[model samples]
Target: MSRVLVVDDEAGLRRALAINLSARGWDVTAAPDGATALEAAASTHPDVVLLDLGLPDLDGLDVIAGLRGWTDVPIIVLTARTSSADTVDALDAGADDYVTKPFAMDVLLARLRAAVRRGAAGEGGAPEVVEAGALRVDLARRTVTRHGEPVKLTPTEWHLLQVLVTRAGRLVTQTELLKEVWGPAYGRETNYLRVYVAQLRRKLEEAPAQPRHLITEPGMGYRFEL
Candidate 1:
């Protein structure tokens, strides 16, 4: 069974989630604060973590950065704070996904599945490097190359790539992309998306004006074909 760590101060919510997740066949673990959650994560090594932004002991962003310092274990932030800035902080800090409070269990399950798939794919990468025409991406090491030379990406750019690659070929909603890549604060900042898209095209696309992999869906969102 896949292991899952749930961190929330609300006793009822924590217990309910533990029971529900257990019913779904996950080995569930619970913590009431950030410090305990971190300990549980490091010691138990869960496949996915359900983190809450409002902790009794520490800032949620700190928890994300703290875990990132030691592991790539996927983190999904669960919070009542719907602000885009809150979402951006968590994502940029190293969270894999964000889910607002009063969320549906089915949607949460889907996010868990996505996180698990990405984590598994990260471990089972091909031995040799992969190329997008002249641009080469090292699947195993999470590095990129252009014309056989390494190409540097900003931290935000890398996170965006992670989201795109995880949902490749599917049209990820603009709000979802922004939440995944930038956080909740940027979910409505379509301008940020436009700027980042241009930046990514300039670096990854052969022609910045016409992109093949990074595609826009008009009023919808973006998708990475590869």
Candidate 2:
């Protein structure tokens, strides 16, 4: 069975998540604040972490940064703040995926399963090749080519691109990408997404300033048009 840590300041929520996850076959642990959540993250090493950004003590983003320094555990952030900036900030910080308040448990659980399964598999770990339009991605080689010419990509940038390409045409949430790519410690670094996305555009797109293939969803995350 997989271990899951649910971190939120609300006691009721913690209990609900613990009970619900337990019922679903996860070995669940709950924490009430960011500090304890970090401690539990290190100690419990949950396969996936469901994080709440509105902690009573430390800022969730800062905690996420701290966790990113050490571990690559999968992190899924929960927030009541629906601002694009909030989502972006959390994603940049290292969160794998983000969920808004008033979320449906069924949807959340589906997302949880996706995160767990993807995390365990490790995004971009495939040694297979992916071909999209003029783009050529060698998963085994971890290389990108356009129009038969090789393109250089940083480790992080390639990982980000892999996330977008794998979910081509789908609106992959900022949280899911962050958690899957950066790990569990980054549940609040949303700004990081813009930076890396910009990097990807610069490298992959013919016109970085006005991208055609990499499209943005206004207040949501980006998508690689297939």
- Estimate every model's Cα lDDT from 0 to 1: 0.81, 0.81
* Residue 33 accuracy (lDDT) in model 1: 99
True-vs-predicted CA distance for residue 171, candidate 2, Å: 7.3
Per residue, candidate 1 scores C-alpha lDDT tens digits across 15-130 of 99999889999999999999999899989999989999999999999999889999888888898995666766676577777778899999998888777766776677633454
Quote each prediction's TM-score.
Answer: 0.64, 0.66
Scored by TM-score, the top model is 2
Each model's number of backbone clashes? 8, 28
Q: What is the lDDT for 172 in model 2?
A: 68
**Model 1: ten consecutive residues of lowest lDDT:** 124-133
lDDT for predicted candidate 2 compared with the true structure:
0.81
